[model samples]
Target: MDTFHFHLHGDVQPLDRFFQNCIGSCHAYLTLREDWREHARLIQREIGFRAVRSHGIFHDLVGIYQIPWGGERVFNFQNLDKIYDFWLSIGLKPFVELSFTPRALASGDRTVFHYQANVTPPKDRGEWELLIRTFATHLIERYGLEEVQTWYFEVWNEPDLQGIFWTGSMEEYFDLYALTARTLKAVHPSLKVGGPATSRNMWVKEMLDYCAAHNVPIDFLSTHHYCADAAFEMGEFSGIHWRGQKAMLHDVQRTVQTVRQSAFPNLPVLYTEWNVSPIHEDVYGKDSEFTAAFVLQTVKDLSGLLEAYSYWAISDVFEESGPGLTPFSGKYGLVNLHGIKKPVYHAFHFLSQLYDEELVSDAPSLRVTRSPEGNVRLLTWNFVEPVNPDFHSDYPLSGGEREEEIVLEGLQGEYEITCYQVDREHGNAFRAWLAMGSPQYLTAAQVEQLKQTAEPSVCDHQRLILDGTLRIKHVLPPSGIRFYDIRRVG
Candidate 1:
C-alpha cells in the first residue's frame, strides 16, 4: 500500500448541493402503494431530495384518462392528487414524467414494464392534447398555481429507445412534445415544461433544434446516463475504462460540453436518471458496497457540471420486468425491498450532512467542508471500478488495499471527532444477507437483522487536542466510503 498526503488549509468556498435536487422512483402507479410511500418518506427525511421523478404518469393503472365502454373520453385526477399530495406532505415536489400513453389514447396496444405501461404515441393528437391540458389544470386546481410552478413537467421517458419505450419516430416524439408543451403552457403560462428525456444522452441536440425550429417551449434539457452507457459508447461489453473509474464523469463532461456549445447553452441540464449500470440485476454495483464509492465519486466529480443528477431510484419496490426473485436481487435502488438501507443510501445520507461551505483540499477523493456552527466535515471514498464488468457474478469489487495520510496544520484546538463508514464490512446489507445463508425470502426477524446489519458503522468517536498539527492516517478497503464530523470543543 502507498500513502497519499493532503494538507488542509481551512480555505473554503460555497458549494452547490446538486445531487439531492431530485431522486428517481420506479413509476407513478407504485406511488399509490404503502411500501412506496414509506420508502419515499424515509428518503425525504434522511436525504431530503427536492423532487421525485418516475415513469408511467399517464399509465392506465394510474386511471388518469379513461373511456368507459360505449362512453365518451373522461379525465380523472383523484388518484394522481393523492400521489402528488403525499409527495408534498413529505417535503418533495414532483419531477413529473409525462409518460406511457394511456390505453384509451395509445396508438397501439404496445407497452413496456411488467406493469405494462403503454409506450405508443397518441392515436389522436387532439385527444392527447386534451389529456395534457386536463392533467395540468387538475394539478393547479389541487396544488395551487404557485405550488405547481415549482414542479417540472418532463415530456416523456427515453423516447429514443424507439420500439422499447416509444413506438414513434423522432419526428413523432417532437410533435407530441410540441403539443404537450403547448398544452401545459396554455393551462398556465408559468408552469415549467421540458423534455427529450432519452437514455444515453441521446437526442438532446436534435430535440433542442426541433423545439427551436418549431417555436416549442422547452424550459430544460433532460436526459439519462449510466456508467454502462459510457461502456457501450466505447464499444466495450467486456469492460469499461474510458477514464478508468471516471467513465461516468467523462460521459457527463462530454454531454455538458455539447449542451454548452448548443443554441440552448444556458438551459438547465438534468440527468433525470443515472447509476453504475442500467441492468436491473447488477449485483456487483447495486447490491454491494461498490455503489457508495461510485456515488460519492460521481457526485464529487460532477459538482458544477449538472443541475440535477437523479439516481435511478430510492428503493427496490421496483418492478420494471417483475419482482426480484430473491431478497438481495440486484434491483437498482438505494434501499432493499425490506427497507434495509444499502451502502448507497448511507452514501447519500453522508452527503446530506455536509455543510454549504466546502474547504479546499488537494485530493480528488477527499471533500472538506465547514459548517456555520464551526464544525468541520470530511467525505472521502476509495472507488474501484470493475474490470470486465459482470453484474451476475458474486465476486467482490474490492481491488486492492489503499492508504492515505493527512496532516492538518491549522489552529490548535480540542475537537470531537466522529466518523461514519460503508464498505464490505460495514453498511453492506447484501453481504449480511449472504452470511445468513442468502435466503430466497426473509422472515420478519431476518428482515430486522438485515436492517440492523445494514447500518453504516459509526466509529472513531473521541475528543482530541491538536497542538499546531494533527496527523491522521487511514487504510481504506477497496470501494470504501467514509465521512468524518469534527466539532471544535470549546
Candidate 2:
C-alpha cells in the first residue's frame, strides 16, 4: 500500500494545457479520406485540440504541382483546399509543415516513405522561390490574411536525417530555409514561420546563430524528441549517445536552456513531433496500457518547458512506412484504424477534464486541482517502464497491485466522488481484441464490442467529510491510470 497526502490550502498556479495544444497526423493527403476526417472530427469534439500538424503539403497527391503535356509546370490548390477546409470546419487550425519537394521541382529522383515523398532539394532556386511565394499568396487569397497568419509555416520535416529526409548538404538546407523564409515573409511580415524541425533536438544552436548572422526571418523554433532516440553531433568530432527513459524531458530541457542562453530566449519553442518511441511497429505504445501512464508522466513534467508538443498522430490511419497491417499493428496513433480509442486517448480525456488552476501535492505521481465552484479534481497513475522495450520484440509489463490512500485535510461538507479508471481490465480495447483471439479482421459486432470495452470503468458515490478529513482509497493494477472528481453535494 502507498499513501499520498495533500491539503486543500496548498500553493496554486495555472495549469499549462500543453498536452492538448496540438496533435500530429500522417501526410496532409490522408486528410481527404472520410475515415481520417471522421477521426479528426471525433478528436476535436471530444478532446478539442487547437491545431493539427502533418507532413507532405506539397506532395503530388495533394495536387499542388502539375505539368501539362504541352505546357510548363502549373500549381493547383483544389486538393489542398478540400483538406484544409475540412480541418477548419471541424475547428482545427493547420500547423502547416512545408515539405517534400514536388517531383517536377525536385533536384533528383530521391524519395522516402511508403508513398514516396520526393526528398531531393528543389531543382532550381528561382523556381522554388516562385512556388513558395505563389503558395503563400494563394493561401492569403483563399483563407484571408488574418486567418492564414494564425498558422505556422515550418520549413520541412527532419531535414537533419540527411539521405532519408533531405538528400542535400547542410549548407543546401540553410539555403532552402533562407529562400522559403524570405519569400513567405515578403508576402506578409506578420505570417508566423520557423525552422530546423530536426529530430533528436539537433541543430538548434547552429540554426539560431546562422539565422541571426544572416538576418533570416524566423518567428519561432521547432524540433522533435523521442525517448528512445540516439543523440549526436553532425560535423567534426561527431559522436552518438543512447538515451534513457527520461530522454524526452531531458532533451527538451537541454533545447530550452540552449535557446535561453542564446539570442532567442523569448522565442516560442515547439516539439512538433513526439511519442514514446519513433519506431512505427512499436507495440510498447500500441497494445499496452503503460503508454497512458507514460504520457501523463512526461506531459506533467514538461509544464512550462515548451509551448506545444504534438503527439506523432491522432489515428492509426497513417501510412508513412506503410499502412498498418492489423487493427493494432503497433503504429503511433491515439486511436486504432477501427476508430477504437487506445488507452492514451483516455489519458488525454482525463487531462482535459482537469480545472485550469492546480493545487500543490508532494507526490510525484499525483495531481490535485480545484475549480471556482469548489470541486476538487485529482489524477494519479502507477507507471512501470518496459524492460529493454524493444520495438520489434513483444515485451510483458510487470508490477504488483498498488493500493493508494488519498487524504485531504480541512474539508467539512458532503461531496460526491467519481472515479474513472484505465488499467488491464478497464478502458483497454487492445486487450479486449486480444482476448477475442486477436482476429485479423473484425466483424461489425466485434468493432462495436471493442468500442464499448474502450470506455473507462466509472464509479460514483457520495460521502460526508469525516471530522474535517476526506479519505479516498483505490487499487491500481500495473501501469494503471485513474482520475477522480469530488464535487460538493446539496
C-alpha TM-scores of all predictions? 0.95, 0.95
Q: Which stretches of candidate 1 lie over 4 Å from their true place?
A: 1-9, 230-244, 395-398
lDDT of 2 by residue, 128-238 (tens): 898899999999999999999999999999888887889897778888999999999999999999988998888999899988899998888999887765433332112
User: Would you list the clashing residue pairs of candidate 2?
Assistant: none
Q: Which predicted model would earn the best lDDT?
A: 2
Candidate 1: deviation at residue 488, Å?
Answer: 1.5
Error of 1 at 388 (Å): 0.3
Superposition TM-score, candidate 2 onto the true structure = 0.95
- lDDT computed for candidate 2: 0.85
For each candidate, the alpha-carbon lDDT, in order, equals: 0.82, 0.85
- Write down the RMSD of all candidates, one decimal each: 2.7, 2.8
Superposing every Cα of model 2 onto the true structure, what RMSD results? Answer: 2.8
Per-residue alpha-carbon lDDT of model 1 for 1-490, expressed as tens digits?
Answer: 3443333455677777889999999988788889888988888888899998988888878889999999987888878988888888998889999988889888798777789988888899889888888888888888899999999999988888777788889999999899999999999888889988988788977988898788899888888877764333211244532234576777788778878887778888889998877777778678888888888888988897888888889888999969888887889888888888988899899999888998765577888777776667888888876666556765444377578775656635888898888898988888998888999989999999899999888968888987766666788888888788888886
